[model samples]
Target chain A: MHDFFFYLFSALTVLTALLVVLCPNAVNSAVFMIVSFVGTAALFLLLDAFFLAILQVLVYAGAVMVLFLFIIMLLDVERSSRVRPDVVTVVAASVAVLLLAFGMGYLFLTGHDATAATMAAVPQVPGGANPMEYATASRAFGYGLFTKYMLPFQVAGFLLLVAMVGVIVLSKRLTGSNEAGKPSAQEIRESEVSQS
Target chain B: MNHSELLTQLSEQYVSTNQWCALWPEIALALLAVLVLLIDLFAGRLRARAVPFAAIAGQVVIFAVLLGKLGTCDPADSGLLFSGMILPTTLSEVMRLFFLLASILVCWLGMLYLRKQDLPRMEFYCLTLIVTAALMLLGQSSNFVMLFVALETVTIGFYILVSYGRNSIFSLEGGLKYLVLGGTSTAILLFGIVLLYGAAGDPSLPVHSGDSLNFLALEQFLAANPNNVLAKVGMVLVLCGVCFKIGAVPFQIWIPDVYQGAPTPVTAFLAVSSKAAGFIVLINLVTGPFGPMASLTVPLLSAITVVTILFGNLTALGQRNVKRVMGLSGIAHAGYLLLGIVALIQGVELAAWAVIFYLFTYLFGSFTVFGVMSHLAGPDDENQEVDHYVNLARRQPFLAGVLAIGLGSLAGIPPLAGFIGKVFLFVVAFQANLYLLLGVAILGVVISIYYYFGWMREAFFQEQTWPEGKEEQLAPIKVCLPHKVAMAALAIITVLLGIYQGGFGGGF
Candidate 1:
């Protein structure tokens, strides 16, 4: 049952990820990307990494996708008019893709034996703990995060704060007499529209 | 163990590992950043006058404290704190001081920059402080998680800084380009970390580690499995991500455009502090977990050095835009530094010191040039071209003289700090038997002289040919007292370091 679920989610992830890239509309691509993230979260759930799975959904699928959608709407990017690739670009891209596909195929087929052997040999968790229970417990994550990973966790908070400040600095409009006579977003949009 | 016992045990372990005192400088810097924002929030009218002074004064105090403690804060005594998350060594201590100094200079530059622009003032200083704190942490991090988080903070702060001049289209364009490329590099770096974690944590592997993200454990794992394919790929990917930060070739496509578009202060910050942070991380990795894999790293870095040197110099040759010229020449400097890294990997321990010394010289030289650039740049910050510098010597000899010393140092001219720095690196590289790389680097330096001199010539030698009626545009730029003092200090430091290597040179 676990193997079956893994395969199902893996296929879902790969298919949705391809659709994300292939979709012409930005909004459609973002939606597909969220689905792909969900598929990845499901796969993580199968591995008993429940905390990671939840974060994958919450952060990537929920928060990040919303941001992507907001940007697409704000920019009002038209459905990407497909620019046809030149012969050189087409040939180069195809050759690169084909080589990657070949390399991946070769690695998967041959590398599986070594990896499988390693996995089979290491069924028991180190320090005599039950891997499933330890991994599934949120308390375990809390302990690790607060103890060993405390510095990084605090630094991550600063990272988010910096990101927030950055967004405001980049997007906020100038006010007062120091506005420097620059055009407003609305004005620029109108001007662009008229020009088009 | 039962739940109560387990809880007690965890708390005990946390108490043992959480050494908060060791992180006082970082904590103080963060608090200073918050204080700057609060001042901005409350002071309102006074903020413009108050914040930059507060930010600079606060950092100067911290810098003094850190400098005083430098002798006592030995890494051997402290070992690893926060459960091996941080390992503060002599290099990291120096870097902490280095970052503090860089932040102070950047705030000074930002003050000059903001006075002329219509941007928000307080957040620039706030973010600069926060990023400096993060960079200090980055140099001290002994674990992958700590390094990545700190690096991301620095990069994100830069994203805002690079685009702080939102009124300028070029600034926004540069910020977007940096955001996309930086995010991609972060992903690549994270992927590499994950790969190493997976490979090293496999219990079937020799000397397998449960905490594979820690440098010591990963080093043990790599030493045991020298031929591990997964680990090798992961190491290469990680290096590639760092290369992007240092603006080495193949990862340097973003440098020219971004450098051209960013505000002068921000471009200076990126070129000096950001690049220095990247080198510190690279040096740590090569000397720590990736030490055992020197066989792979030495050759790989040599090839990159060759290309980076030649490519950076050749591309920089035709650039008329001064910032673009700086950007491309900065790439070549990265190549020279890469040569030092290669030597370190080849067992020349002194190469590490050489790299740090070079970075110090780079800071002095680059900031001097940037200081001049900021003073001369008009309201349209991005349009600073080489031609704008004509007749600069005749009009403002002080600025012209500073520019000449800065450029001369960067070109590795004798009797400047940069020349000494290059000599140290080359000596170390020679000790490592990197004769071919040494040749390419010298050739690259010779090529770089053409452009560096080209800028200097414009300032000192080029005849003024202002279009009729536009002669007023070329009037003498009023160099403010603070800027003059700062530029003079940097120039004096360059000259002093060149003449007397002192402790920095003698120690290595």
Candidate 2:
């Protein structure tokens, strides 16, 4: 059952990811990426990474994807008539296959029996970090995050605040523009004045 | 007992609740960040210059606390926290200390940078703390989940800094490019992590309760299956994502634009702190979570190093934009650091020593060059072109000399810190039998000379005219408090590191 779910979601993820990369229109690609993200979130769940799965939904799907869509809609990006960056596409495709081959080779040589034995030892929770026996992801991760790795957790929060400020500051004001489609800041101001 | 019953018992018995000692640095940084923000919010009531002074004071306190924590963490430790998701040991301690120090310098320069720019100074200081805290976490992360979160935290801060000069379209463009590329890379990183999770997930539970994002499990996982194709694929994708952070080739697309478009002080921070954090995280992942999987990691980093070296130097050759040139050169330097990572695969080697020393030495050198650039670039930093430096030698020989020394070190000229750093890495690579990569690295350095000197030619020898009435464009040869202090500190240290390559226990 686990294998079935893994394979199912893995295939869906790859397919959607492909659509995201191959799709011509920005909106379509963005939508495809959202699907891909959802598939990954589900796959994380199937893998018993409940915390990670929730984070995927909360962070990637909820916050980040919405932002991606927002930018896409704001820009109203259409498919360029240019031929889809053919060289980059081909190179990326080839590299993907090569990496896939390498992963397969690494997997084939792994120690299965040793891993199985380790798995058997997990449920006993001899040292208390064996998440295998735990029913909820939050309990184990929370304990770890708050106690042992609390510093990193807090630091991660700090990083988020900085990123938020940085984005707002960087994207808000533009002094000069040359050789491009002009932003509508002037028009908006004019509309505001007319309204006034 | 039920599974929950068993877990509850073990949690009390083995997972001691006394791990706060391991969390000192992070706590300090977090408190510092909040304190700065609070101070900034109420500076009018408190006092004048509260923002920079208070921020500096807070940072100093955090720095001391972080150092004290580092002094306490045992190197031989294999301790685990939060269900083995975070590990802070010898490696993390070393990285944490370096990051803290770098952030201090960045904050200092950032404060000096904002005085005349008229950008909001308080928010800038506040963001500095926030990013510093993020970088500290990035250094200690032992799991994939934390890795993603920490990486995003820093990148987001950078995006804001890049575009902080909202009035300029160039800054916006840089921010936009970073956002688009960063978002794409993050997606790729997530995909990679999920793939690996799928390949090795536990089967006993309905949802795999033990995805094992922690390094210990990952190490066990890789050594157990050196040939796991799916896992290997995941690792490569992860590396690609990290590679983007470090400005390595292929992922080098955004660095030039972002660096050029960013404010000078911000560019200095980006080049030093952001790039250093990326390497620290890379070292952690390669040596920790991905440690078992050398068959893939070694070759990947080696190849990346080679290509990164060649590409960065070659592209920088033609760049007229000073910032863009530095951006490309930054890529090349990342390649040099990757060499240290590749060497660690054989055994726990001291190759990382060279990388650390180089990062430390380059911080001063790069900061000096960018500091001068910022001063020249003016309030909005409009002039980024190489020709802007024509006759700098004639006008500001002292500043020109300092730039020369910085560029010289970057080009790996002998009797300079960069040369010693290169030699240390080269020896390590040689010992590891990566002769081909060493040869490529040497070639890359040789190529770098042309580009580094190309700028020098404009700055020192050229006779190009400035736009009408821009005589004060060049800084004075006489050193000021800030510039002199920064230059003296970096120069003295760099010369010391280069001349006495043996002792001082620095490259740990």
Candidate 3:
């Protein structure tokens, strides 16, 4: 059953990811990207990484997708015109795809037995505790994050703060008369009228 | 073990690993950034003047303190802190100082840039401070997680900075292009990190590691399995991501447009500090976890160096825009620096020092040129043409002299700091037996002189032919007192470093 569900979600992920790239409309591409993220979350669930799976959904699918959709709407991006691939581009892409397919095939065929043997050799957990139990618990992630990963956590906060400041700097309109040396909106309008 | 005992053990681990004292400079930088933001909030009318002064003053103080504490802060004595997340060696200490110096100059340039354009000034300083702090951390990071987080902070800071002149369509266009490209590179870097983690964490491997993201453990794993295909692919992908940052060929498509469009100070920041950060990270990887994979890296980097040198110089030859010329020539410099990396990989230990020296010379020369560019730039910052510099020597000889020295140094002319830097790198490359790469680099230098001197010609030798009513546009550029002092200091350093190598010149 685990194998069955893994294959199902893996297929869902690859298919939707392809659609995300193939979709001409920017909005549709973003929607397909969300579906791809959900499929990845489901695959993580199959691995019994319950905490990661939930975070994946909450962060990438929920929050990040909302931002993508918002930007798409704000920009009012039209359906992108799909340019026809020239002969050279088509040939080059075909060669790349063929090489990739060949490489994957070669690796799987020769390495299958080695992979099985390595899996058998994996060391068991101490005291025979279920590995999934430790990884799946939300508290385990919290402990790791607060303890070992404290520096990155703090830096990520600063990253978000910078993003916020940057958004305002890029988009904010200075309109007040109090702004030193800067032309107010009224002054700017008058200057424009004079120039015209 | 009892539940209470386990809890106590965990707390003990946390207490032992969290060495906050080692991170004082980074912490102080973050605080300074916040203080700048707060000052902007409350300073009201004086905010513009107050914020830059505070930011630059704070950075100068931190730089002094870090320099004083340099000898005592070596990781050789203290070992890795934060459970091997940060490894502060003598090199990282120097990088911290380098980044602070760059940030201070960038803020000063930002003040000059903001005077003409009506833009929000405070955020620029705040972001520069935060990004500098992150770059210092990036140089010291011993874990992939730390590296990624710090790198993202720097990249995001640059994205906002690149487009800070939001009123200009060119700035916005450059920002979007950088956004798309930078995001793609980050994804590639993340994917590579994930692959390495997966490969190293495989319990079936001969020497598997539980903490696969740590550089030391990953090094051990890689050393044990020198022929691991997965790890090799991961290493290449990681290098590709870094190459994008340093603007190597095939990944340098964004350099010309972005440099031409970004505010001059931001472009200077990207060219000097950002590129320096990328090289430091590359050096760390090649000499650390990727050390064992020298068989794969040396040949790969050699090929890239060849193409990057020839391509950068050839493309730069025909460029008329000064910014585009700087961007392309900077690529050729990256190629020269890559020679140092290749030498380091081939067992020349002193090659790393050579790379750092070259970066220092680059910073001095590039900033001097950028300082002049900022002074000469009109209201439309993006459209600085080479023709604008005609007869600059007659009009403003001080600025013209500084521009000549800066461009001459960048061209690796004799009796300039850039010449000494190239000599050291070539010596190291020769020691490593990279004869072909050395030849290509020399050829690249010869080719670069044409363009660098072309700009010089426009400034010093070209005759001015003003069109009707164009004399106002070509009026003598006024250089303020502070700017003159700064540019003079930079130019003097370029000449002084060329003549005297100080401590950095001893070993080479």
- Give the best candidate by DockQ: 1
Ranking by DockQ: 1, 3, 2
User: What is candidate 1's lDDT per residue for B1-508, written digit by digit as tens?
Assistant: 5543564576577658779889999999999999998999999788888999899999999999999989785676875589888998899999999899999999999988887877777899989999999999999998998999999999999999998887677887898899999999999889899989988988877788878999999999999988676787788889989999998887998999899989999999999999999999999999999999998899888999999999999999999999999999999999999999999999999999999999999999999999999999887789999988887898799999999999999999999999999999999999999999999999999999999999888888887677676757455689878789999999999999899987877755
Q: At residue B312, give the lDDT of candidate 2.
A: 89
How accurate locally is residue B124 in candidate 1, as Cα lDDT from 0 to 100?
Answer: 95
lDDT of 2 by residue, A97-168 (tens): 998777566555652432333343345444454554364557766655555455456556666677666655
| Residue-level error in angstroms, candidate 3, position B474 | 2.4
Clashes of each: 0, 27, 0
The TM-scores of chain A alone, one per candidate, are 0.75, 0.64, 0.74
Residues A18-110 of candidate 3 have per-residue lDDT tens digits of 999999998899999999999999988887787888999999999999999999998788887889999999998999899878866765565
Comparison by TM-score, 2 against 3, better one: 3
Q: Model 2 chain B, poorest ten-residue lDDT window?
A: B202-211
TM-score of chain B of each: 0.98, 0.90, 0.98
Query: lDDT by residue for model 3 over B259-307, one digit each (tens)?
Result: 9889999999999999999999999899899999998898889999999
